[model samples]
Target: MTVLYRRVLGAALDDLPPQLLALHDSADPRTWSGQARIWRGAGILSRLIGWVMRLPPQGDAVPVSVSFIPQDGGEVWQRDFAGHTFMSYQYQAPNAQPGIVNERFGMIDVTVAFQTDRDRLVLEPMAWAFGPLPLPKALLPTGQSFETQIDDRFVFDVEIAMPWVGQIATYRGWLLPTE
Candidate 1:
């Protein structure tokens, strides 16, 4: 049977790395959940930032889920971390720049660069903006990494830091499709 893969982030479903595509192209789409060993970076400021974001306190494992719904030009990614939902809007315009995934976190515009590294697909934050004003990238501390294990499970590690605030928050976890 031929499987239909939907666009994720901004890359065409078929153009994505094979392994990465398989992860998103599951038998069921309505609901998916998994568990991971969640971790919060050290330092008081990092913990404070985590609290503000509503991230679960440093835990060995936590539950996460994503509800993906197709829209006119893109998809709605509603992510449930631990239990809090961080909603984001994603879309791809007809003439969008190559390798760019445009997303809106609340009112902030976030642009991410999508690329393939070996067998993994990586998403790197490129820029951010509020309304029509663009924010200086140099003033933001950002990091991104995503990889799929040999067994088909996925692992993600992301961190955001500020100049004097040091490492704001970092979380890493593995996830698998729930049957």
Candidate 2:
């Protein structure tokens, strides 16, 4: 069966590295764990936003785990970063072209576009909404978000920055299939 990521990525799915492909290839629910370094902005607005988003605290080599639960046509990702858990549901974007996916964290939903830079699978936030209200494009977080195979594991680096608030959160890490 074609999985959620595979359906959204379409032909680009073939370009993924072995590790990335392995991570998204499965149709069954599974979990992955690894270590990560996390950071957050110092500004009050950034902190408030981060808190609302349930962002993890700053730490080095923090243990991280993510559970992927496949739903009807979407997938729910439950992530545990040092026991501070947050979840997001992802699926093909409604009324969007292929290579675009929608991710929802609580009341916030963001449409993401896929791109390939060298060996990395880059996720770019195209649009975002808080609840039913569409937010300004300037408020949408941007920066680096990509996944790649580092050695034998799947590695990810995600840096989220706003217009004037600057970087709100960042986490870099690697994941291996939980045995």
Candidate 3:
């Protein structure tokens, strides 16, 4: 089966850098391990939401592991930073353009537009929903989630921020495929 990102990116997948392509083109379950730095927001709202969302605690060079399990038309991603664990689901956005993908982190479902430019894959949030109810685009919580190949490593940076609450958390790191 075609991977979710490859399906969304279509023929454009060929244009991605080798490191980026290596991570996305797996036919079997894949696990990558590495280290990361996590920064949590200092506000009360940010902490509460981070806890509810199972965001990792702030730490430098924390152990990180990511496992991707393929599904029918989507994939389930399990992530671990330090000892904290979280998971998300990814699938093609129904009735949307080729570059749009729906990702659900816990109860919050987010639609993101995927853009590939040379070596970088950027995920820009375009819509949000909780359960079955649609949410305002203005309040979508994700900001500047992207992945790229840097210095022969698969690097990722994801920022979670809301309208008035400010930065919820940012986890940035590099990983390599592990047996």
Candidate 4:
């Protein structure tokens, strides 16, 4: 099925950091595997929510794998942590709007914001909805960062926080493209 839309890396994505641009350059689909350490903040409520979200338990460094499959207008991202498949998301890149992500739970609108700190690229949640009901963005505090480390590894960090619940989960890791 051909999805009619602008290129995945359009003008809006031109300002992205070189490292991020390279990492997300999905013109040729491939898989990358590496090792990473995962961490989750502590709190009873946070732990409970993390469990419900299928987040990995706090642990030392483990193996992580990711695959990027290009589509007509966007891509599919599949991630596995420590040999366990966590989640897969289908992304749709709009012509002049934030990218849309369709996950198992719901659909989320994500805006890519560039941080001055080392030209890091951050994914900010703009809107979220389940079924036909719109949900408050505050209810789902999610953050994602991509940066290049000194060792030339592509680093990725993700955090999900909820009001009064502290940090539900967080994971930081580095990856190297295998092919």
Two-way lDDT contest, 1 vs 4, winner: 1
Candidate 1: tens digits of C-alpha lDDT, residues 30-136: 44566655556578887786666556555566787867665555557687877767767676545667656777766677777777666666778788887678888
Of the candidates numbered 2 and 3, which has the greater lDDT value? 2
Cα error of candidate 4 at position 6, Å: 8.5
Cα lDDT computed for each candidate against the true fold: 0.63, 0.91, 0.88, 0.62
Summarize candidate 2's per-residue lDDT along 1-179 as a digit string, tens digits: 57988888777777889888888877999999999999999999999989999999999999999999999788999999999999999988657798888899999999899887778899999999988999999788898899999889999999998999988999999999999
**Candidate 1 whole-model C-alpha lDDT, 0 to 1:** 0.63
TM-score of structure candidate 2: 0.96
Best-matching candidate per TM-score? 2
Off by over 4 Å in 4: 1-18, 93-118
RMSD of each: 4.1, 1.1, 1.1, 3.8
Candidate 4 C-alpha lDDT tens digits along 1-179: 33311243345454655545566655667787787777787888888877766777777788888887776455666788886665545555344443433443323434333343445655566556665676776775666644554466777877777777778777788888886
In model 2, the worst 10-residue window by lDDT is 91-100
Q: Cα lDDT of model 2 overall?
A: 0.91
Error (Å) of candidate 2 at residue 43 is 0.9
Preferred candidate (lDDT higher): 2 or 4: 2
